[model samples]
Target chain A: MPFSLLNLKALMPEIFLVIVASVMVLLDRAVREKAFFFWMALVGTVVAWLLARESLDLHFGASYLSDHYGFFFKTIFLLVLFLTILISPGYAKREGFHFGEYYGLLFFAVCGMMLMASGTDLLVIYLGLELMSLSIYVLVAMAAGDPRSIEGSLKYFLLGSLASAFLVMGLAVLYGKTGKIVLSELAGWLTSDKAVLTGILFFIVAFGFKVAMVPFHMWAPDAYEGAPTPVTAFMSVAAKAAGFAALGRIFLLAFYPAYAYWVKLLIPFAVLTMFVGNILAVVQTNIKRMLAYSSVAHAGYILLGIVSGTKEGLSASMLYLLIYAFMNIGAFATVVLMQREGRVGESIFDYQGLAKLYPVPAFLMLLFMFSLTGIPPTAGFIGKFYLFRSVVHAGYPIIAILAVLASVIAAYPYLRIVMLMYMREPEREIKLAPSPYIWLALGLSALGVITIGIYPGSLLTSVLASVF
Target chain B: MEKVLFGYLALAILLSALFAIFSRNVVRSVLWLLVLFLHQSVLFLTLQAEFLAAIQIIVYAGAVLVLFLFVVYLINLREEIRLPKFLGSYPLAFIAVLSMLILAVAGLVGFVPAKTVGSLSPGAILKVGHTQILGEHLFREHILAFEIAGVLLLVAVLGAVVLVRRLREGEL
Candidate 1:
């Protein structure tokens, strides 16, 4: 309970974001220029990013820790927020739903993501998770004219509340079994007790639902497709990364003693997730839903790192998550760009012969598609390589092979888009939504993907160093 | 006296919960839910948790139930009542519920409550008072979480305004 200066400093960025977001909420009502909120959020994110620093000290009774691990995820969250805001104004304005609450909610969501990454206690992490989920539910329902948006939001809210209930139950059981909630302290109370296993299983289910692992991923496609493109992009990467952040920390720290048990339990789920996501993605006509499935598959890949139960594996997942934020958001940014007056650009066939006219977006989409397929010379390849190598190193060569097969199946849907863009003629005349900011966001993502794709050693080493 | 009150509260809770779920009239169902909430609060009171009892009444019975009533009022109650009371797949739902009940009972039957030593034990709660002890923890140890909850409420309000407001072009 002692609030030290250092602890206050550790929480500076989160506090700053909360303040800025609250002020923006006020400003949004008074200001006429919707673009003003965008600038505020953008500047706020930059400031928050600069304020973030790695502090190994655990603040507030081991509830929060500002460490390099959290710092890495925070950077990703900020990057996502920046990119999402960049791509949002045009879509929001075009769709006639431009509001300051949109940007404010995003800031709050990022603050939640930051807390999730940094929190070392179950209570804190749960609070963070709820904060993030609530913001996202509202964001998804922002398009008032679209019934699909409301449906998706409601679905997400219901399923998410169930998951939260499960998590609370798990936390209660764990607390009863151990009288502890802090990650480091919980390790000391490890037992082969049935209650502990039950609690752990509940936790796994909740995390699985959060990260969109198969069987628990029923809401992802519906929610992703129905949501605004920018929100979809934000949720797919930032929210999933937050889930994995907490998952990795809890498993590696609190449940490390029972790694063999949980790893075995998780492997099948991961394998199922990869196959379900990839195979289902192939049949999707909507680009957003396809990317939703693709994101689910990517979650399966990230789980390989945790399933390996190695520092290398954990860092590998972190690296993959960073790469994913870029390529996935980049893809969604393109979808946001494809939104014309009448066409929302939800269908994959809409991209046909796009290379003939809007060659730049077509090529950018091509780059993203290739990257998603884990093609070399892109960040996705580097990410997949590390994840596979780490899993193989952990002696799960079979899971690694299955992951590769899943990746192969994944190649078909992603490459099909590439082929469609270049080969088929446009079924109709395509006019893109005008957004200068989207280009900036897309360019940043492409740069991140290609730069890290080619020169991955530096990013990899930093990620390796950051792992807790 | 405590045992008698506890027995009555528990029975009332179960009966009201059943009534809430089975009532054909949606408003009547919500009213039954209010009864369930009231019984739950009395149960908490019997347990000597005055703060929880108060919160159960204020938050659940007072606030949440009222909100539920408002929502039910907004919708066409006659049409809702006319709609099928249950989905066609009730047998499947029954099976799922039965299995879950069995599993939960099985889990609980085998479980022995571990003696969790903490600063605020039952004896301490009686000495320090329930609300004060809770406030201390809320404002002291878990202050960050408390603050986060505040922000969450703010976002929830924002969400309500954003979703329900009329789309005004430029001048609102």
Candidate 2:
């Protein structure tokens, strides 16, 4: 219980992000150049990544963790942050938004997320959640021109506040029952008591809302559609990844005793979320809304991995989250580039016959779409394969069957987007002046998806090792 | 006498919490929240957590709720502010409260079965040796957690600064 600077050093990645965010905010005010904020965010994230890698060399044990799992997630979060900054510059410039505050808020949010991934105590986790949520509410409303953005911000704030209240209530009840706030201590208490089941249920509801699972997913589409494309990409990937990380930690550490309780509760929600998300996505014409529903389905798949309740299940969920970041960011990056004159091209009709006029951009979009649909030789396919295999291995063959069926049903909208690009005749000629950074993001994501699909041995081995 | 005083304080806390949740006006709700927070600090004091009580009052009631009030006032000028209606769900709320009361009673009853052992006196803190007992526990056992709490408070201060400063910049 001795206080040591070594403990502080273990949190270097989060500390670095906080420092960068502060500096970015100062630089944004001092310098008028917009590109500076973007580059600063990117460089800051890379430095954070290096710091996280360094932290992985430290010892990990109960109550305090520093290890491969945290390192892996920190890297993924940094990569997502880098891509978010890359795609944001053009959108920020076109929209006449204050660039520095945007990146500053982003870095702050990333810091919260990194802390959430690294936090060992329930109190720290709750604080991290609030930190992330507060920053994102501002980011969602950052674009002043859109009335929808304001509405989305209000809705997200209200609903997110409600979720936070539920989480706090759960924590309070758990603390009152056990006189402990650290997850390890709580887990020890849970072994002897069934009364803590109510607290666990409330915690599940809180996390379910954060991840946008079926019954709690009402606010997602509006929020996703209303935010700027880059912000949407960041929220979809980074926010959800952090949520999953926290969820995994809670289940593995605190709620392991009540696994039977949650497992029963989650199965129905997982199936419903998958079925509803896919069915809804099939009817959506708006690109953003479609992606939103797809996100819901992906949440179900992640939940499916959780329901398996094994170390393999947890590792597979992490892999799926990693792959999900690349596919989602690539998809949204293409969408961001398609914006012209501050108007993001969000309609499915707007994408029609894009291949004829903008071959390379359209092709890249096709690659993203294919990857999202879990086509062979893509990270998405491998991600789903690991998730399904884990579930089946855990004796949930029926869940895996439903998951495959849902994925097949979900592929329709993704393929439809690809078909619209490749097969349709042009109604209006479109020209996309590509940015090198955008191309760099897309190419990197595409290459990652394909490379991981072909040989997932190293990543899988590392992920498996981290879990055990 | 102490038991009666503690009972009155607990009742006040419960009433304020109810008022905070059910008040129609946002301003009234915030005021009730402040009262409830103050009562919470008193409870912390009763538990001999003086440091925590101070933080409870300063951070939650004094600083954070003031920010909430400020934001509420700033946004009050918006046209057609929708005051959230508490639908005809009073019955549900009543049922929830009733069930919680029943559960509390049940727990109290259950505690008696395990009470063959003599209970620790609530007034034992007045003993001279009790001060050392409390200090030893705080400094020796809970020291790491205590320091971490300090770090958390520092982070919270920084967060508040960032949020308020950003708002100022927006105004500029």
Q: Over the stretch B1-172, how does candidate 2's per-residue lDDT look in tens digits?
A: 7788689889999999888787767788888999989888888877676767888999999898999899878889433356564235888769976985675455334221111111223454445344555675455444434444554454445445544565445446
lDDT of 1 by residue, A1-468 (tens): 344443577788999988998898778768988778888889999999988863344464557888899999999999999999899988888667777777888989999999999998888999999999999998898776677788889888888998998899889988887778788989988786777877887898899889999878988988997788889999999999999999999999999998878887799999999999999999999998899999899999999999999999999999999999999999999999987654457788888899998999999999998899999999889999999999999998989999999999999999999999999988876878857899999999999999999999988999999998
What is the alpha-carbon interface RMSD for each candidate? 2.9, 6.5
- Which tens-of-lDDT digit does each residue in A1-468 have in candidate 2? 343343566767777777777677667657977787777778887888888888875632333466677777777888999988887877766655545777877887887777678777786678778778888887887665676676777788888888898798778767766667677677876743444666676787898889988878878888998888889999999999999888998887788888887798789998999999898999999898899999999999999878999999999999999999999999998888887754547888789999988898888888788878889888898999999999999998999999999999999999999999999997865656468888888888878877887999998999988873
Task: Output the lDDT of residue A83, model 2.
Answer: 87
Fnat per candidate: 0.50, 0.00
Per-candidate DockQ versus the true complex? 0.48, 0.16
Global fold similarity of model 1 (TM-score): 0.94
Output candidate 2 Cα RMSD: 4.6
Question: Which residue pairs in candidate 2 collide?
Answer: none
Residue A166 lDDT, candidate 2, scale 0-100: 75
TM-score of model number 2: 0.86
